[model samples]
Target chain A: MQWSTLIVFLLLFVLVTVLGFVAAHWRKADLNQLHEWGLGGRRFGTWVTWFLLGGDVYTAYTFIAVPALVFGAGALGFFAVPYTIIAYPIVFAVLPRLWYVAHKHNYVTGADFVRGRYDSPLLGLLVAITGILATMPYIALQLVGMEVVISALGFPMSGWAADLPLLTAFVILAAFTYTSGLRAPALIAIIKDSLVYITVIATVVIIPMQLGGFGKIFAAVPPAKVLLAAPVGQSLGMYSAFATLALGSALALFIYPHVLTGVLSAKNARTLTRNMAFLPAYTLVLGLLALLGFMALAAGVDKVPQYAPFFKQYANSFAVPALLMHSFPGWFVGVGFAAIVIGALVPAAIMSIAASNLWTRSIYRAYINPRCTEAQEASQAKLASLVVKFGALVFVLALPATYAIQFQLLGGIWIIQILPALVFGLYTRWFHRYALALGWLAGMTAGTAIAAHLKFAGSIYPLHVFGYAIPGYAALYSLILNIAVAAALTVLLRLLGVAGGQDQTTPGDYRAAVPDRDSGAGDGQMAAPPTL
Target chain B: MTTRQSSSGIHPRLWWRLLLLVPIIATLWVPWYNHLNPTFIGIPFLYWYLLMWVPLSAVCSAVVYFKTRDLV
Candidate 1:
C-alpha cells in the first residue's frame, strides 16, 4: 500500500470526523430536540444552503459514476450534465411555495404536508413508506462509493478492520448528525465541495496532459465503443435509455426527501429561490467529472485490481476514481479519494436523518401512538437514523454491485412519485385526497413493474421503459401514467362528492413568512443564523 | 402578476442557445465522431470531450444564470 497516500487520506478522514463532532457545539443549541438534531434548527442561510444542497444533489456517485459512464459509452453520459442544469429552474418555481406551506404548518416531513393537504393519513403513510424505502438504498449507494475508494487504497479489513471502516464512517456520521443534526453535513459539505472542486479542476488539466494530450487520448478509443458501439450483439437502445434517464432524473431531483430537507431547512423562501437560481454552477463540475469517463476509456483503465473489488470500471461510473489514481500525483490522489469518501458520508448522514424523520413523524407517531411527545419522537428518530444507516449498509453489502447502482436509480423513481403530493399540492388542493393515494399507488406499481421488465427482458421489445427496454425509462412512463391516473381519479372523486379534506392553511399560507403571523414579533427567524 | 424582460438577459439567452454549437464543434475532436476520416487536431474525439466539456459547461451555465436571474 502507498503509505504517503494513505497518510494523507487518514488525515482528511480524521479532520472530517472532528468537524462532524464539533458541528454539535458549532450551533450551541438545544441538542435534545428533533429540529436541532434532524433539521439543524431549521435555519441555514443561502451560502451554507448552497453547499449543503449542492453536496447532497451531487453525491460521491456523481463523482464516481458520471465519468465512468462517459468513459464507457461516449456522448450519452453527458445527459446528467443537462439534467442538473434544467433542474434548478424547475425547483425555483416550485420549492419556495413548498417551504412556505410546510413552514406555516410546522411540518417536519413531506408526509406531514401530504397528510394535512389532503386530510388522509393513509396517503401520508404511503409517502412515508416510499420515502423510507427510497432513501435507505440511496444512502447505501453513498457507502458503496466510500467502500470502493477505501478498498482501492488497499485498507485491510479482516473482522472489525474491514467492517470497522464502514462502521466507523457511519458512527462518526451518526454522532455528528445525532449531536448537531443537519449542521453536521452542512459543515462537512464545505470540505466535501472544496476537495471535489480542487480535485476535479486539477484532474481536468493534469490527466489529459499525462496521456499524450487531447488528440492522442481520443485516437486510442476503438470505433465500436463510440456513441454507436454495442458490446458484441448489443444494439443502440442505450441512447434512448440515456435520454429517458436524464428526463426522469431531472424531474425526480426536487422530490427526494433529502432535497426537501434542504429546502425546508432554509431560512426563507428567498434563500431557497436564490440558491436554486445559482445551484446550476455545480453542474459545471459534474460535466467535468463526466468527461473523466471518456478520459478513462482513452487511458485504457479497466478491471479493478483483485484486492480492490469495489474499484472496478464501468463507463460513466468508475471513471473518476480510476483516472485519478491512474493520472494524479499521490498526495492529490489522496485528497480526491478523501473527497469521494467524505462526500459519501455527508449525503449518507442527511438521507438517514430524512428517512428517520419520516419514520418518527409519519409512521411511528401516526400509527403506533397518537399521543407521542416531541421528545419521544425525537429519541425514536435518532435511533431510527442509526438503524436506517446500518440497514442501508446491509443492503449495499447483500446486493450485487450493479444491482445496487440500479437501486439508486430506483430511489429516484420512487421519490418522483411524490411530486403531485408535494409540488402540485403546494399550488392547489384541488386533487381529492383519495385521488392522490390512488395516483401514488399506480405510479409506484407501474414504475416498478416497467423497471423490472427492462432489467429482466431477454430480447427486443417495442420500447424500453425506465432503463428497462420496453419503451422509455420506467420512471418517465409510470410518472405520466401516474399523473394521468391522479388527474382522472381526482375528477371522478370530486364529482362523486368526495371532499379533499381540511386545508389547515389557505392560499395566503403559501405566501406566509412567519411561523405565527399574529405575533409580528422581531424574532430572529428570518435572519440568517451566525456561521458556526 | 407581471412578466419582466430585459435586453441584458437577451444576449445571455442567445449565448446559451448558441452554446450548443461549441460541443458540436468539440464533438469533432473525439475519434468516435470521425466516421468520415476519423481524426482532428491529432486527438481522437474522445480526448477532446474533456476539453470541450469545460467550455461547453460555461455556456450551459450562463444560460441557466440568464434564465433564472432576477430580471423582473
Candidate 2:
C-alpha cells in the first residue's frame, strides 16, 4: 500500500478534471449550438487537432493492451504497428475529403454525410446506428483500461469495492463531458499525450538498460513467438493474420465516429494533412510501447506479487501495469497509471460526443423531429452524450470485460462495412443506394458470424478461408465478401434501371481549398435538395 | 456528383495513383519477408520490415498530397 502512489494518482486526476471543466470556456464557442458543442466549433487548429486526434485514436487500450498482447503472444502484438502505419496513409487521403465535404455541408456525423450524399434517411440511419454500435464497446474498453490501472494501484479486488472506484471515475468524467462537450477532450488530450510520451520513453530506455538490452529481451521470449510463427511455405500461420489484421484495422480506423469527430473538428483540410505527416510519430511511440511487452516479459511481470494471483487466473492484459508498478518508484508508477486513466477520459469524451452527434443529426433531426431547431439539436446531443457514456458504463460495470473486448473485436469488422457507402460516396456517387445498404448488411452479418464462430475470443480469432487457416484478423476476410456482394448487387441494380438518389454535394465541394468559412453556428438544414 | 475530372492544377494523377500503390503492395501481403535473419538495430526482419513501412508510407502520402493538393 504505497500511499505516495495513491496520492500522486489522485492529484493528477484532480488536475485533469479541472482542465476538463475549464475546457468548456477554452475555445469560447457558443455552447447552445450543436456544431460548437459536438465539434468544438469545427475549427481546431493544427497542434490542437493533432493532440485531439492523437488522443482520440491512441486509447488507454494502446498503452494497456498492445504490450499485453505482445507479452502474451510475443510477435503477434507487433501487428498494431503495421495497422497504424497503413492507417495514416489512408488518413492522409480520406480525412481531407471528409473534412472538406463535412465542412462545406456543415455535416456533424458520418451518417449526416451519407444522408447528404444519398438523400436517403434509412441509409443515414444505418450509418448512424453502425457508428453508435461501434463506439459503445470502444468506450467500454476505455473503462476497462482505467479499471486495470486502478486495480494495479492497490484498490480492493472483485465485488462492489472495485466497481465503486470505476463508477466514481465515470461519474466525474460524465459531468465534465456533459458540460464541456468536444472541447473537454481536445484540451485534456495535450496533458494525456505528454504524459504518455514521457512514460513510454522513460520506460523503454530505462527498462532495457535494467534488463540488458533488446538482445536479451528477445532472448527472454520463446524463440518461436519471437519471430512470427510462419510455418514452412505458409505465411497464413502468422503473416496472413498479421497482414489481414493491419489492413482491416487501417480501413476501420477512420470510419469510427470518434476519429471522424476529431477530424471534422479541424479548421481546414491543411490541418489534416499536416497532422497526418507527423501523427506517425505516435505510431513510432506505439512501437516502443509494444516493446514494453518484451520488457514486461524480461521483468518477470507476470510473477509480480500482487498481480501473480490475478494473471494466474485471467489474461495477460495486466502485464504492462504490473511491469510499471514493479520497476518504477511509487510516484512514477502513479504517473504511469494516471497517464493511462486520464488517457481514457480524452477518448471517452470524444467518443460520447461523436456518438451523440450521430444521434442528434442523423437520427433525431433526420427522422424523429425533422423540424427541430439548432438549439434543440444541441440540447438533444447533450442528453445523448450522457446516455452514450452511461451505456458504456453499464457495459463495463455489469458485463465481463471479455465481452466488451469481444464486442470491440466485431467493432473493427462491423464498422468497415460502412466504408463503401461513406468513403466511396466521397469520390463518386455511382453505387446504387440499395446495393450499398445490402453490402453493409452482408458485411455485418458475414464478418460477425465468421469472427464469432471461431473460438479465439478477445483479439485473435483463427479464420478458415477456402483451404488455408488464417490465425487471426477475421475482418479482412469478411471485407472481401462485403465488397463482392455490393459490387455484384450494384451491377445487377444498374441493369435493372434502378436509379440512385440525388447527391447533395457538388464537384467544387470535394476540392474546396478553403471551405466557405461558415461561422458554422446555427447552420441550416440539408443543402437545398441538390438543385437537380 | 460532378462527373468532371480533376482539372490540371494537380500533378499527373497517375504518379499519385502509383505512389499510393507502394504501401498497399508493401504491407498488404507481408509473408515473403517474414524472417529473423536481417535484424534492423536489434529488431527482427518480421517486426522491423513492417515498422519501416510507417515512415515509408508517410513519405509516399506526403508526395501524393503535395502533388494533388491543388487539383481542381
Candidate 3:
C-alpha cells in the first residue's frame, strides 16, 4: 500500500480538511450558540487547553491498545505508564476543584454539575444517561482506531473502500462538527498533537534503530512476551490490568462526558488549571507509545494474524502501523499513517461533541422542550452533532472490530458510574436525589450484569473477577462493582427517610465564578438555580 | 475564590520525594531483586527499564510544574 505512502496519506487528508472548515472562523464567536455549538466558546487557551487535553487523553485506543497490552503482556503495559504518572497528581488535586465548580455554576453538563450540585433533575438525568451510555462506546472506539488504520491500508474487505470509510469518516466528521463546535476538535487538536509527537518520538528512535539496538531488541523478545512476564497469568495479569488500567484510567480521566466537554472548554480557571499541570507532557508521549509494544514484539511485525486468546494474538493492534512498517522509510510510512489518521480524527471530533452535548442538553432540554431557545439550543446542538456522527457511523457499520475494542474498555467501565453522581455532587450536598436515582439504577444494573458476565464467560477466555482472571480488561472490575452499588444505594436511601429533592445548589453555589452571577440566562440575573 | 495565583516560575518542589527513587530503582531494574547480582550498566535486569523511565519522567514532569505553578 505504498504509492509514496498513498501520496503522504492523501496530503495529510487534505490538510485535515482545511483545518476542519477553518475551525468555524477559529472561535471568533457568535456561532448561534450551545455555548458556541457545545463548548468551544467557553474559549480555550493554555496552549489550546494543552492541545485540547492532549488530544483528549492520548487516544486512538492509546495508539492501539497500549501497544497491544505491551505486545501481548510483559511489564504490564507499563500500567499506562504509571497510571499516566499518577494522573497528573490526580488532575492537580481534583481538577482545579472541578474547574472552580464548573466555572462558578454556569455548569454545562457533568449533568449540568450534577443537576446544580444535588438539587437534582433526577441527578441531572443520571449524569445525562451516564453520559450517553459512556459516550457511545467512546465514539465507537474512535471508529476502532480508524478500523486499525483501514485494516492496515489493505482496505478491501469487500467494496466501496471497505463499506465506505466509516461512512466517509462520518460525513467529514459531521461537516466540521456542524461548522466548528468545540472548535472543530479543538482546531484539529493542533494537527492532532503535532502528528502524535512526530509519530511517538519517531517510533521510539526509529524502531530501536531498525531492530538491532536496545540489546538486539531485548534479545529477540519472547521472555514469554514481556509486560513483565512469568505466569502471574503472564506478568501479574498484565500488572493488575495495567495497574487497574493506570489507576482506573487516572481516576476516570476527568470523569468523561467528553472530559467534561474538554474541561468546560477552558479559557479561565487558570487555563483549566494550567492544562491540568501540563498534562504529564502527554504522559511522556504515552510512555513512548507503550514502548511500541517492545518494538512490536521485537519486529516480528505480524500486524495481526496471531490470535490465541490474550485478546486474540496481539501485535498491539498494528502497534503504530507495525512500527511504521518496521521502522520508517517507505516515505516515512506516509508520515506515520498521517499520524495515525490524524489520530483517528482527534477523538472522532471530541466524541461527537461529547455525544451531541448529551442530546442537546440532556435529552432535548430535559424531556424535549422546556421552551427550548438559545437559537433552539443552538439548532439542537447542531443537529445533535450530526446525530452523534451517525451514531458513531452505526458503530462503524454494525460492530465487530472486536466489538469496537470491547467498547472502549467498556467505556472506561461504564463512565466510572458517573463518579458518584458527578464527582460526588461536586463535594457533597449529601447524595439522596432519590438515592442518586436509586444509585444510578443499581449501578447501571450491577455494571451491566458484571459487564455481560465478563463478556460471555464461556470457559472464560478474557473474563473473571472474584477468583480473578481478566483480559479484555473487565470494565475496570465492573466499575468496582459500579461504585459499590452507587455508594451502597446512596447510604441506604439516606437512612430510610426516603430522600426528597429541591436543594438545587447552595454552598454559596460552589463559590461562584462570576460571568455575571450564574449566567443560566433568564435575564433577571441571579435567578440561575432550578433544574427540577 | 480569586486571589489564588501560585506558580512560582521555575517551580520544582519535592514531588512526592520522587517516590524515593522508585524502590531504589525498582530494586535495581525490576526482575524483582535481579537474580543474584545481575548486570546494571552492561544492562539486563529487564534492560534497566529503558534507563529507569528517563529520570523518573523528568521528576514527574517537574512535580507537575511545581505543584501547579502558583495555580492561577
Candidate 4:
C-alpha cells in the first residue's frame, strides 16, 4: 500500500466533501422549492453548465471503461470519440428547445414536459418510471467505478470490510447531496473537471515521453488492434457496429435523466446552445483518454508481475488503473485516482437528484398528493434522493458488478425509447399520446428481450434484412421499431377520428429566452405565464 | 395559435443550421476515413481523422450558434 497515494486521495476527498456542503449556500436560494433544490434555480451560466454537463456525461465509469474497451477490443472502442463529437451538434439542435419550453412552464423533469405537452399524466408517469428505471443502474455503475479506484488504492476487498470505505464515501455523498441538492454537483464539477484535465494531460504528455513516442506506441500495438476490421461476406461487420454505436449513443446521451438535469439547469436557452458549441472540448479529452489503452499495450503493463494479478481479475477494466500505477509515482497516483472517484461522485449525485425529481414531481405530486405544497415537494425530493442513492448502494454491494453492467446496457436501450415522447413532442403535437405510450411499451419489451437473448453479453445484435446482415446497436434498432409503431398507430388513430391530447405549450414557448436579456420583450412576454 | 405565426416563423439564417449536419455525415460515413495510410505522427488515419472532427464539429456548431443566436 502506498501511503502517499492514500493520503492525497483522502485529502482531495475531504476537500470535495467540504465543498459539497458549502455549495448549499453557494447560490443562496430557498431550498424549499423543487426547482431550487433540483435544478439549481436555473441560474447556471455558460461555464458552469459546461462543467456540469461535462461532469455528468463523461462519467468515471466512462474514464475507466472506454480505455479498457480500447485496450481489449482496439479500434472499435474509439467509437466513443465520434459519439461525443456528433452528440454536441445534436444537442445544439435539439436541447435548446427543450430548455426553453422547460423553463417557461416550470417543468422540473422530462416527464414534467411530457405531462405538460401531451396533457396526459399517464404518459408522464411512463416517462417518469422509465427515467427512474434507467437511472438506477447508472448510479450503480458509478459505484462500480468508485469500487475500482478504491480497490486500486489498496482498500480491503473481502467480507464486510471490503465495502466499508465505499459505504462511508457514499454516506457522505448522500448527506451533501440531500442537503445541498443540485448545486453540490454543479459546484464540485468545476473542481472535478480541473483535476481530470490535469491528470489526463499529464498522463498523455508524460507517459508518451516515458515510452519513447506515439510512433513507437502505435508500432508496438498489433496491426489488427490498430484499425477496425474490414467488412466480411454479407456482413458490414465491425464498421456497422461502430457507426451505429456512435450514432445511437450520441442520441441516447442527452436523453439520460442526469444529462437533462444538467441541460435544464442552464440559465437560459442561449446558454445551452452556446454550451453545445464548446462541450466538444471534453470529447477531445475523452479521445486522448481512449488512446491510453493502446499506450498500456505499448508499455506492456500486463507483463509486469504486480499488475498481472489485477489484469487477471478485472480483465480490460483494470487497464487505466494499471496503466496509471505503472506510469506515475505514488503521489500522482493518488491525484489521478481521486479524479476518477470524484468523477464518479459528480455523476452519481446528479443522477440521484434527477431520479428524485422525477419521483417527486411526476409521481408523488401528480398522484400521491395532488395538492402538495412547494416545500413538501422539495422535502420529498430530498428524501427520495437519499432513497435512490441507498438503492444504488445496495445494488452494487449485494449483486455482482456484472448485473449492474447488464442493467446499464438495458438502461441505455430503455431510456432512448422516451426520445419519441420527449424530443418529438417538442416540435409537433401530431403524435397521439396513447400512440407514444404504446410505442414506448413496444420498444421497452423488444429491447429487453433482445438484450436478454444476447444474455446481456453484448449490445450489438445481428439484424438480417434482404439477404444482408447488419449488426448494429440494439438501442437504435429498437428505437426505429418504436418510431415506426408510433407513426403507424398515429395514422390509424387519426383515421378513426380520435382526438389528440392537448398541448399546453405554444410554439413561442420553444423560442422563449430569459425575459430581461433578449431584445424583444414582446416575444418573451408571450411565453410568460406568471411563473406557475 | 395566433402567437405561433409570430414565433415559429423560420429564421432567415436557419439555413446555417444545415452546417451542423456536416460533422454528422462526415463521421457517420465510416468507410471514407477507415484506412491506416497517411498516418500523422505515427497515429493511424482512422484515429486522428475522428479526433479532427472533434474540433471541427465544435467549429460548425459555433458558427451556427453565432449565425442563429437571435432565434433562441
Looking only at chain B, model 3 earns a TM-score of: 0.30
TM-score of chain A of each: 0.89, 0.93, 0.39, 0.94
Q: Where's the lowest-lDDT run of ten residues in candidate 4 chain A?
A: A523-532
All DockQ scores:
0.11, 0.35, 0.03, 0.51
Better of 1 and 3 by lDDT: 1
Q: Write model 2 residue lDDT over B9-50, tens digit each, in one string.
A: 333453564776677678766666678868866667877777
lDDT of 3 by residue, A1-532 (tens): 6677777877887888888888889748888878777887776778887787778777776787666666665455556666665655555445556766677667777887777666667668777877776777677677667766755555555566665765676678778878877887788888878877887877777777777676677667675554243336433333344445556666666788777778778866556655554666777677667667777777776534432122342224655576676567776777777777677778767877877787778778987897887888888878876776666656555644532345565666667767777767666766666665665666567657766665522111245557666553444555555556656766887778774566555543443243454454422234233211
Report the TM-score for the A-chain of model 2.
Answer: 0.93
Q: Write the candidate numbers in order of decreasing lDDT.
A: 4, 2, 1, 3
- What fraction of the native alpha-carbon contacts across the interface, defined at 8 angstroms, is recovered by model 2? 0.39
Q: What is the TM-score of each candidate against the true structure?
A: 0.82, 0.91, 0.36, 0.94
Per-residue lDDT over A32-94 for candidate 4, one digit per residue giving the tens place of the 0 to 100 score: 999999999988999999999998888865678788778888998898898989998988899
The full ranking of all candidates by DockQ, starting with the best, is 4, 2, 1, 3
lDDT of 4 by residue, B1-72 (tens): 112123534545777899999999999989998898889988889999999999899999999988777666
Q: Which candidate's lDDT is highest?
A: 4
- Per-residue lDDT over B17-63 for candidate 3, one digit per residue giving the tens place of the 0 to 100 score: 35434423442233352231254532354435543554564465456
Model 4: CA > 4 A from native: A394-408, A513-532, B1-8
Check candidate 2 and list the clashing pairs: none
Among these predictions, the greatest TM-score belongs to 4
Docking class of 3: incorrect
